[model samples]
Target: MPQSLFSRMVLILLGGLILVQSISVVFHLRERDRLLFRSNSMESAQRIADTLRLLNSLPPADRHKFVAALNSPTLRISLVTPPSSQPRQSPDGANQAASFGMMLRDLLGENPPIAVTVSEMEWPARQHEVNAPYRAESIHPRQKTAFTVETHLQDGTTVSLDALPTGQAFPLPPRLLLNLLILLAAVIVLSLLAVRLATRPLNTLASAAEKLGNDINSPPLLETGPTEVRRAAHAFNTMQSRLASYIQERTRILAAMSHDLKTPITRLRLRAELLEDDELRVKFAKDLEEMESMVAATLDFMRGVDNPEPLQPMDIMALLESLQADAAEIGHEVRLQGIAAQPYPCKPTALKRCLSNLIDNAIKYGKSATVIVNDDDKQLQIHILDHGQGIPEAELERVFEPFYRLENSRSRDTGGTGLGLGIARNIAQMHGGELVLKNKAGGGLEVILTLPKPITSGSMATKTGAASNIQAKKPRM
Candidate 1:
């Protein structure tokens, strides 16, 4: 199916807006997560620091009890005392004490001036790096001094022992997802509304354009909408008005010219009647007759060009039969072919003039004329066939130009002014129809005139009148 410009525009706009909003939502979530993570990390670090200070003031036995009571895999406590006189030794000897002293010395070098050691500890569920140490100070508030502990996670985050429990480090905010969803919905709805509002005027402009070709006299379009839309509509309306006025002016000029030429042509014919020589008088009269015919055909052609008659229903078969009988009466062989069954909506006078010209041309040039009326549910086609010297492919289109006769040889005997086909085409177009000329399969030329079907009650009435007239005239009777 074909898509309208307005719908396509809205679709493109909405799609782009959705894409941009989606990217924004992603970035917003990332930024929010970063902020929440930092906040949680700081709070955990502060709690851990406070816990370590409390642990350092307790005696060794009480400190062990406190550590056991706190029992968290993420936290550990240790006590270290310096040797009194000789080097202290256990079953493992100097190596163990030397290792422990070196680790504690490294911890004291870290910031906050507290001794702490970290060792990799492996367990069944997870692995951790834990460290803790104590120091004695004279100015300390407690009996001895203070100890500090630190833990590190695999993800590159470090927590001080004085920090709070990592178990409650950060919890996801409950309303965050709901708020994001609301924002997303609002954005989509607002975008769609904006698109609709912006494209409404464009739709109106398209509709107006479609109608313009068929009805040039339609009222000016409503120039409302965005600034650009209003400007475009105003320009279009101005162009339509100018085109209509130009056509009207041209028609008036042609009518005036035709009226003015008739007086001189008539006077010349009257003057030729008094000529003394018989041969000369006959030739002059013949010339005058030819000139008069050309003048009349030219006037008809010009009138059709500008003032198109209104549409009415016409009997397709009847119109053809009338032309056929008229040709037969003139001693020309003419036949009616196909169905004369249906009536179509068209301009009656314009359509009749168009078909009459076609038949006249056929009879004049081909010496015989045949008309066929073909009808379908949707439209009607009228074909006028003539057995004559068909037009050359090159001259077919040129034949429809005003005053453009075929070649000198063909025009000599026929006395054609070359306006027949041009006038036929003009009449056909006035009725929203077209005239097409083509070479027949066997010989001669076929002229096809196509007209639209009627759709209203008033059209049906007009069609009935034309149909009755066609049926009343019987060739046999």
Candidate 2:
């Protein structure tokens, strides 16, 4: 249930590896147990057969003396009276006894009837209870397994053999567990590295897409890596190239149309001047001016669609001061406050134009403009406030559309072509920033231009400067 592809892949690979290792270990243990059982059975049969041969070769009284030498921890040999009936055994015990009997007969070379029975024996039990020669006290109490073999010798004497398998195949040693852990750790580390490598291309593609949104002219993705990655990068680069071409072509066409329309407007203005009636001439000139203005504004909007200006670091406070000075020269009231701690990366010409439009709108509508700058490592925010009746909530966003003005009178004196906010927002988005408008609490409009700081911006403390309200006053005549 990992959210990331890397974590999911690692989980699946590790889970599969752990599962396979478990199965492999199980099969390995089972096979080892099987081989060990065969080896132990053969060894036990040979030992019992050799003991019988020795007993047959020796005198009857001496056979008892050899019994002590034949006895061992895993195997014990003794003489006993023949049982009156066959021994009872469980299903699994019966299978084991039958297989062992076959092996014993093969070793002995005689087809004598061998009564073999496997039984579960608890620790500290009396050896006489199951008729085993002796208990295997060296084995752990948990094992609790014993086998009894009774067969007749050449002299009609019955010999009893007890065997306790070593059970070496089941228990896992500490060293082996440590080795398995080490191997698992190594495999997990390698899997993480491989998954990261495989998913790295996706990260690159996403970054490229974000950069593309900010600047169409941003560098293309490098067509390197696996075949699929290369193909994707190539496609993205192709799309970017096509989009850039389309924007350039549209700008060119708009510029040409603006030039062509201005020629007829100029001719018409000259013809209007020659009219005999002054009132009619004034009306014609005004109409011609409005048409020329609309054409110029349309072209400007088209140009703003894509500005190829390269980004560079600029002092934002200096730009604000210059704008304030320009407004003062025009007899417009402008106030400035706050300081930028560091230079911000932006298109200097485009940014200056964006700020100029907002400040001009504030002065024209609100009679005065107050610019407050809030700068930090993360982003630079410039808030332009005005002291006019705030716009209605419904018309706030509608005013951003090109040529859509709130002044239904359509008088140039009341509101210039409504493309200022649109062009300004376009420039902000080009720099990967945002511009938003809000109604101030104190009966005014507030426009906030938020520009994000680059990752490498320096860490510096920004201090608020004393507010300087500049007003242009006409000199005394």
**Candidate 1's residue-wise lDDT over 1-477, tens digit each?**
228655676677667877887898799877765565445444344545555555655654576677656544344433433323432244433433243334433433443433233222332122323333232221123121112344432232233342222433355567876886787788778867877888777777776775565456667988877789889999999998998888778777866877888889789988899899989999999887887777677677766665556656566667776777777777888888899455566666656677777888887778888888787765678888889888888988999987887774358466777777887787666655678999998989999988655456334644366443633321110
Q: State the C-alpha lDDT per candidate.
A: 0.63, 0.78
Question: Per-candidate TM vs. native?
Answer: 0.65, 0.74
Instruction: Please give, for residues 28-134, the per-residue lDDT of candidate 2 as tens digits.
Output: 87777666777767776777778778888988888888888677666677886755775567886888788888887888888987888888755343434434555
* Clash counts for the predictions, in order: 10, 0
The residue pairs that clash in candidate 1, if any, are 45-163, 47-163, 47-164, 48-161, 48-162, 48-163, 48-164, 49-162, 49-163, 50-162
TM accuracy, model 1: 0.65
